[model samples]
Target: MTTTLTTPTTTGPSRARRVAALARGETRLLLRNRTAVVNSVLLPLLLVAAVPAMDLGGDVPLGPQLLSTAVGVTLVFLTYYNLVSTYVARREDLVLQRMRTGELTAPEVLLGTAVPSLLISLGQVVVVAVGVAVLGEWSAPVEYLLPLVAVLLGTAVMTVLAAASTLFTRTPESAQITTLPLMVATTSLSGLLYPISSFPDWLSTVARLLPVTPVIELLQLGLAGRTWDGEVVDAGGAWAAAPLPLAVLAGWLVIGGVAARGFRWAPRR
Candidate 1:
């Protein structure tokens, strides 16, 4: 006679317990690593402090501009760059593969691993927001709430992007090279170093299509309580008015979801 055997299903606390244990383990690993800690925290702090000294002045208030810039930088470095590096490192270490055999689902494993990074990012944002509000004299307009939404959406997109990027990264150390293209391109084009309005027409058109552009536009609009009304054109000279930054942000979320669907917890052959 042939016999069938099935694995037992995990119960509520079993799932929660697995997530909690993973969170603790990941947190300890992150905190113990000096380079990771500095990259995650110190770098963002320096950028936030340095932006005000550059004297990029205009009709836009310093408060909103600094706040927007600070938050944007934080989102990129903390959520995007840090998460990608960490995920690659863990996968190379077989941490991700081991976790998959536990009670956690793929989504749960990803989220659980990400919890520590997310908490650190959120803490940094809060601290920077307070500092900007006090020293930079930043008071966000009521409409600025919309940009906060964009900031959040941007973080989610960044997380998924990190996951997808891992497929190309074979080792933790190689992540720096793999991540550079997106990081440099997004940082330059996303209005981190310069305002998008100042870009040449052709460059601006291309920049608008990059994921970071919409997030930055949303931040600028939220801080200033305005929207982008400029023309966006493709190479063929087919032009359309820029959609509301909010709409652009929502679209990115959809794209991130699609990208995330293909992310693998185990290495692909």
Candidate 2:
């Protein structure tokens, strides 16, 4: 009998599938880390709760300010700090190095590792938004798209910045120290805890350029439909208010990406 030649076809998981699988695994690991879980889950809500207690002393509406604080804190501590620790831990364990030799590409590996944190941050922000609407008696956002765009781009910016942070973090424990500068800058200068409007004009201008400031600004504008200077804007006006912050975020994405290019996947010498 003549034998016919046969070819085999191989199929692999899609990029989304791959990332999801990695994210699931990461979630399991993250759950085991009590500190990470507490920080990611509890700290942000607590901080947001504390926001109303602060003598915020401003004309800005409390509801939108609370929402912005929740999102900014989540992005900072949950996504950015947690990802920095995860990246360093994975690199130290050679997990990143081994993954690099597999079918997963560099960007895939980074994004996959970051997926859990990103998802958690987004979910928490949604929860906070609902809480703001219900318990805080907040109205629906006039410019929903601005806050949505802010959160999406803000996540991307934080992810890249997290990857960049790992370049300085030698170990997971060291992430606390290495993460501080951005943390300080974001919390203090980004107007998350204070109004940039209260700053001197030049300082206010500079604060607007910080990485997380635009995201907070966008959220404020979207939720309150009011600019920093107390100008009321309709939905269409929100689009006009977006270009500067969007450009600033885009610029930071570039800066963070360039820095992350030098990230070490292997254990440090």
Candidate 3:
């Protein structure tokens, strides 16, 4: 039998398309991980439910604190914590190393790996906002646009932190320990559960300096516009807190970038 063979096209899938495919694969893997799925969805909700017990100050109210808690907890568990384990798992499995040897660039691989987590984090943020809105009325209108800046910037910071932390993570199982410092420190002192305004002058000042503080601050500034009487309040207005936190976020981003330069794609020897 005689047959004619056709040559394949010189152009394959576009770069964006390839990256998208990678993200899809990453998302599927995340879905298959039962623990990851549960933590990403349920953990944030559980954490936020405790806002009633948190002292976000008398003026801040449980509703506003709940909203802030939802955003902060979701971002931490869904994006930052998840990425640490995922990156370590990929490194241990040799997936990252294999990708480096193929057509996918390092940046593409990192971005692709982040896609699933980022999407879930954003979804959690939405759920938090909706639940807060549906529960009752905000004393002041939600500054939807301003807090979005915090979410976007905070996510970038967390992504970098995850990448950096994975360098020390020996295995997927060790991810919990490697990730604990950040989770514990930030949750306790970063105002993730409580408001900075609820703090004494000394504590609020110090809290603002923590790596995670700016994120929680920005989220609260945007989502929780309640007034506080006995606690620390910044001069000027709610917007006054914006610039300093933004600058702090930028500084952390730089540090994360510097740390990433030493990232080891291959397993540690």
Better of 2 and 3 by TM-score: 2
lDDT of 3 by residue, 7-104 (tens): 22324456577679999999898889898788777855765455445565445556666666666776677678888888888888889888877777
Candidate 2 clash pair list: none
lDDT of 1 by residue, 96-148 (tens): 77866766677667777888888887777676677776575676463535566
Which of the numbered candidates is closest to the native, going by highest lDDT? Answer: 2
The most accurate candidate by TM-score is 2
Which ten contiguous residues of candidate 2 have the minimum total lDDT?
1-10
| Candidate 1 structure, TM-score to reference | 0.82
RMSD of each: 6.8, 7.2, 7.8
Q: Give per-residue lDDT, candidate 1, residue 1.
A: 11
TM-score each candidate.
Answer: 0.82, 0.90, 0.83
TM-score of model number 3: 0.83
> Model 1 segments beyond 4 Å from truth?
1-18, 228-243
What is the clash count for each candidate, in the order shown?
A: 0, 0, 0
State the lDDT at 116 in candidate 2. Answer: 81
Task: Give Cα-based local distance difference scores for all models.
Answer: 0.68, 0.81, 0.72
Candidates ranked by lDDT, best first? 2, 3, 1
